[model samples]
Target: MLGSAGRLIRAVVDFALPALCALCGRRLAEDEVAVCMECLTRLAPACAPFCRLCARPGPRPCGWRGGLCSICADHGRQFERHRAYGLFEGDLARAIRLLKYSHRRSLAQPLGVLQARVVRADYILRQAEIVVPVPLHRTRRRDRGYNQSELLAQAVADLTGRSCTPRILRRRRATRTQTKLTQDERLANVRGAFWVGDPGEVSGRSVLLVDDVFTTGATLDACAAALLEAGARSVAAVTVAVAPAPPTGRGRT
Candidate 1:
């Protein structure tokens, strides 16, 4: 009886004030959730010509060696591999912004399910024994009231059938946003910022780190390094989107 009443109320409310796509602002169909199909189709997939180690889309830099991008070839990465669902542009970027800044927490479900599809198709990513979300600093999390990555991680774990272990990783300090920082500065800022709360939770396990975006990969690298130091067998990363490489003479995006 309660279920029927709830459905009726939702139906009336939806009819009166239909839900709209979080990205495009288009009215959602009865079957659709947070985003419209047209907006979703506009989200470009992170396919080919990308760095194998870090999954940075586009051509490798000049003098690239060892089949890795110049950055990876030079500094190397702590994670064994990384994958992203789409390029960070257009609808995809908007969708992430809605979830992260606008507090449209509902968007995390669809975005994470989409990311899981990418993970499902990759044999390497599918082998993740456990899923972990990058941790937010305690103060920041308290201010936000929720961790966006943790919400995404839960959805991904549900779809991928992996255990979501969010409490195992800890952010020791809050760092400034990487938005305008240089690549080197971004690395330095996040370095030693993460730690494992319980090494036994990640020890001997293949952890798949989840995040909203992959920029210069400094944050992911830092998290992966901490996981590895805690005796994790391997660490791989997945994100909803990957920001494009910065233009010449520009700081990291």
Candidate 2:
């Protein structure tokens, strides 16, 4: 129903603004966001059959007798509980990699919105007074230009009406990447990497720790320890992706 001029303008706009899915590299439909429906279907959720404490996918989907993984069973985590959207694989993993390594800043909001929806549905995030991301060192943040976890935590705060208090939790020193590190090495790598800048910021408040992935729980556990030491009432965590059980062979988050 358009005239020649209108049709020409429409065509040019479409050409100039091509829509592509961030995960699968497919052209997006008219109303699609960063990810396409096909890619979404390909992505798997961290449903039951996962560890009750850490949310790691397990062989016994419905048979978590004690609802604990070996890590959670042998030694308790510093956080009260952990929740993850899905495993770090396929489109989800690709998307996270793009956000973290490839400098895909636009993908953060879309991913954050998805994660915020997950948090809004959970009562744990609702009860938390503030959201604090697993902080990065000054050098790392400078090199990265931005912290992806900070973006995610802010989006969650926007959706759930919780305040993002990142200043309270900070990295005291830089450490080697968790990549290529053994379980014990991962724990020691992040052992004293984090600290609370001001105890009053989170004193007497329950906090939610945000991270991109849950590998060994070392990083989030370290952050939780600092929060608790500073007088936080309680601490829980939510990550976009949760890794598989022990003997993991993935890169750093």
**Number of the predicted model whose lDDT against the real structure is largest:** 1
What value of lDDT does candidate 2 attain over all alpha carbons?
Answer: 0.80
For residue 215, what is the lDDT in candidate 2?
A: 82
The list of candidate 2 runs beyond 4 A from truth reads 1-19, 26-33, 36-42, 61-65, 246-251
> What C-alpha RMSD separates each model from the true structure?
5.5, 7.6
Q: What C-alpha lDDT values do all the predictions have?
A: 0.85, 0.80
Please provide, for model 1 over 12-88, each residue's C-alpha lDDT reduced to its tens digit, 9 standing for 90 to 100.
76569868988778888987778888877777787777888888865654435756776788999999998999888
lDDT of 1 at 49: 72
Q: Residue 173 error for model 1, in Å?
A: 1.0
User: Candidate 2's residue-wise lDDT over 114-177, tens digit each?
Assistant: 6777777778766788999888898788777678898888877887788998777998889999
- Deviating ranges (above 4 Å) for candidate 1: 1-17, 60-63, 248-253
